[model samples]
Target: MKKRSVVSASLLALCLLTLSSFSTADTLENIHQRKKILIAVDIGAPPYGMLDGKARQSGSDIETAQLLAKDLGVELEVVPVSGPNRVPFLLTKKADLVIASFSITDARKKVIDFSNPYGVIQVVVGGPVKQKIGAFTDLIGKTVAVTRGTTSDMELTLGVKEISGVNIVRYEDDATTNTAVSTGQQDYIAAAMSVIPAVKKANPSRDVETKFIMKTFPLGIGIRKNDPELRAYLDKWVQINLKNGKLNDIYKKYFGVSLPADMLN
Candidate 1:
């Protein structure tokens, strides 16, 4: 009886392992079979993803997703995601890839794998030119707006804990944060470098300028952990595009600067 029970357990384990292997391989083949790749993008984040005057999706991230679909020879279906939900969308199978300006971090690596970085962004502290905010000490007693659940949010949160009198206001997205800054609802903003330009252009009279850079993070395409096939393809795709200047062109068109030399290398 004992021997029979042990043999049954071994067979069940083997069956589960086989199924896991099949699921991993399906990550890539499923796209080819369906002729569509579902990518999650944060359309509310300007310069990365946004809607144009025609209400059509347009931005660097949008173009990157389109390029990936073109190379895969598949139709592109964009799944709109926000900072808080990009990982959830990928893990829940709502998106096969997340190209939503997701910064690769150690905490996230434990849950999902990331492809080679396709872009980089600085977490910045920005305020009007007349205000003096060059460091955390400078932020004392000032309210700084930040998009919820973003790397900028995390960085700023960690940065202000030990520093007293710094007020951090959380918003749902960059658009809302931009509004808060433009309308004087908030004194400053903790955000990506991209958001600064958008806010500055929209409110030219505000003269918003970056005060200090918190840290730079590499942006990676988020994929489910254990999906080796998908990660492999994305890794190769990023390398080729970066080397060929296609990615830089997209960055320049939106951000007015070439991709960082360190990233291109």
Candidate 2:
């Protein structure tokens, strides 16, 4: 009887250990078990992610998320997010990941983890080629358009103080900001270089050209801070795709050019 009691106690402890292991499985494992992953992407940001003519989400970031889901052998569920809400969605558990052209910054690093940079983008000032603005200083006393609450808006807002009398006009979105510039509602517009091709394509008669680059920043996949397993998997995924030229292929499909060599570095 004593021997049987001891054996039963041992089996109970083993079962408890197994249950604890299952309970503490990392996020990647959970995603696999659930057979789906929720990805947050900015549907308004074109070339990166945006809505199609049918109002379905489609773009480079959407394609990237689809690839991730395929690799994971799971279903992809896209959650539309904006610039300010992307991080919030991740932190609030509304998204399993964010691939919304989120730039890697020291401040963001404090709140969320970023995977290895998968791409790079340039923030630039663009206007009619005939416009006299040549540099940041030239914007003084001129009105510049930018998407509200974006990095371009922040950068231009902060930097313009050096050149007194500049007027910054904030628009609700990039399309609106581009329209404001193309229609001469604003003298210049600050935007990502990636969006330039689309802008020119839409307004073929407009001679918009980059006046000067404001900044170049690397974009990374946003992940939860504590999910080391998921972070490691995503880092490896980026490295493999980058080395295999898959990422460049994707970029070319959207941007009409291969990824820049500097971006690879």
Candidate 3:
């Protein structure tokens, strides 16, 4: 009787252990099981993500997400997000990861992990040719427009404290912010370097150009901090695609220039 009872207890323990393992399947496993990977993207940010004339999703980040899903043999489900909500979406499990031109910053790193940087963007103060800005001090008395809830906003906010009378106007999206600059609502905009050409196209009279560079930020994939499997996979995936020229192809297709060679290296 004792021997039989002991054997039953051992079987029960094994069953419980097996159930626990299945219940704790990580994010990658869950994605595979569902046959879909949800990637958060900001469709409002052009060059990084946007809607084509036919209403199709197209851009550098969109293509990168598509490549990720294809390589993983899963369907891609994009969760449209803005700059502010990308981290929230990840924290709340709304998506597996964010690839929406997410720049890696110390504050963000404290809350989430970033895969190795796959690209870089120069944040600058863009203005009309008549307004000159050779240094940060030049921004004094200028109203700078920036997209709310973006790194550009945070960095510029901090940067202008020493320069008195530097006003900043915030907009909800990149398009609106660019419009503000083109329409003379703001003399300058703190945005990616790509914004200059966009602002010029919106209103040729603006003739926007980079006045002064705030800083260059490294763009990376945003994942939950504790996700070792997803983080490792993404880091490797970025390096592999960078080396293979696929990522650069997407970057050049949108920006008309190749990614920096160092990122590939």
Candidate 1: how many backbone clashes?
0
lDDT of each: 0.90, 0.83, 0.88
Among these predictions, the greatest TM-score belongs to: 1
Give the per-residue lDDT of model 2 (tens digit) for 1-265.
Answer: 9999999999999999988755532779889999999999987788899888898888889999999899899999999887767888998889999999788877789988999988877888888789777778888777888988777877787778678888888887666777776666775788888766667777787778888888888889999887889999999999888888888788889878877786555
Of 1 and 2, the candidate ahead on TM-score is 1
Lowest lDDT block of 10, candidate 1: 20-29
Task: Tell me the deviation in Å of residue 7 in model 1.
Answer: 15
Ranking by TM-score: 1, 3, 2
Q: Candidate 3 at residue 151, lDDT? A: 89
Off by over 4 Å in 1: 1-25
Q: What is the lDDT of residue 199 in candidate 2?
A: 72
Instruction: Give the per-residue lDDT digits (tens) of candidate 3, residues 26-139.
Output: 889899999999999998787788888899998889999999999999999999998778999998999999999999999999998899998888888887787768777888
lDDT of 3: 0.88
Q: Best by lDDT, which number? A: 1
